[model samples]
Target: MNGNGTLIHLDNIYTAYEGAAFPVIRGITLSIRAGEYAIVGGPNGAGKTTLLESMNGMLRLTHGSATVCGLDVRRQGCEVRKRVGYVVQSFFFDPLTPFTTEQVVMMGRYGLLGCLRRPGEADYAAVDRAIRLLGLEDLRDRPIGTLSGGQQQKALIAQNLAKEPEILLLDEPFSNLDLCTRDFVSGVLKDLAKKGIAVVMVSHAFDGLPDGEIRIIVMRDGTLSLDETCRPDEVESRVRKASTVQ
Candidate 1:
């Protein structure tokens, strides 16, 4: 962590896809601190997902630098990934995939387990804690592929939480959830932030934010348009206003 408890830092960074004419996200500088709940908002194709990838080193940096957990993002991506948990925009499992919800969540600890090392008591304990936190005890033994979309979403989150990451990045996590489920999931994320985990999420839905001050980041044309802290109730309007500004 930095002097101010900044857990993730990106300095004038540019990220590009292979063979792409230009960077997907350019000249982006961002800092996220422990126990923060930051929402990344923007119109589609505005580079919100790219920014999240840049922070976790999932994409190659074409220019500038990034540091997460005091490690160089480009050179130490493996280590960075261990400390960062990312839940993608969407995921699906075949009905016959065979992994149980408990098994799926246990996968999150694989990176830390190293090759040929099996999970010990600590690993199982962590997985149990995540499952309980996500209220997945009822579905723990069920085949992950058979769950409803919202159930699967909760399972995925539990999987990430099992990693005990310092930074958690989520992309469009609420896309498949109903209002009630959204509220439930939002509360889980809020609790994560309270526990000193940096929670950064990209989402279009704004109705389910927890009651508290939150950070809103709006992107436009691959750059930052707005970055500020505001109460949860003000987020939708502020993001909408910023996104519409020409």
Candidate 2:
């Protein structure tokens, strides 16, 4: 821990999708500090994704509160999102989509550019850095939809990185990657953590995790059942046991 204080704070939050009568997640309380690597795990429909959405201000908090990067999530959603990078679990791009890989990555900086502001040299530099970080230089000119699944995933990650966010939230990041690709991506995330970027991932697969202590959070139904720090090797077992209702 870096003793830099909390980066994400959720105090008894309850969130629900619009038009849904019942909230999907409730009574959720958590605190995450800077430079921490956290994994959210549980069975299907375990509210894992909902928790991530709440943190990013995608879902409205029906009760309680949430703060990310010291900005109030409810009141400062636009500001929070500007600083938080989120990669969705699954996405499909139409084959004819006109955006090139570089263009898509540049979209990440759009929030910061704001209305009437164009991307300048510094923005281009950031995009180039992110593309190189994900090893996507060769594919930068290719249409995003034309790339393979693994390549597209890398592009998506690069896009988020272009924003220079303090926190990176990934949902099932390895879903489209193979064993070798998973290893590569894991190492990439680990390196980002070393640079003090908080990497919070929601995933089901436990293999190919980065080395070091990991913060494991297991959610069941709509509430957190376990939150603990453990060695990477113990994560699978701990999550498996904690996911079951006690």
TM per candidate: 0.97, 0.97
Q: Candidate 2, after superposition: displacement of residue 26 in Å?
A: 0.8
In the predicted model 1, the residue pairs found to clash are none
lDDT, residue 108, model 1:
95
- Candidate 2 structure, TM-score to reference: 0.97
Model 1 bad stretches (over 4 Å): none
Residue 131 deviation, candidate 1, in Å? 0.8
TM-score of 1: 0.97
Per-residue lDDT of model 1, residues 58-151, tens digit only: 8999999999999999999999999999999979999888999999999999999998999999999999999999899999999999999989
Clashes of each: 0, 0
Give lDDT tens digits, candidate 2, residues 71-181.
999999999998999999989988898999999999999999998989999999999999999999999999999999999999999999999999999999999998888
Worst 10 residues of 1 by lDDT: 204-213
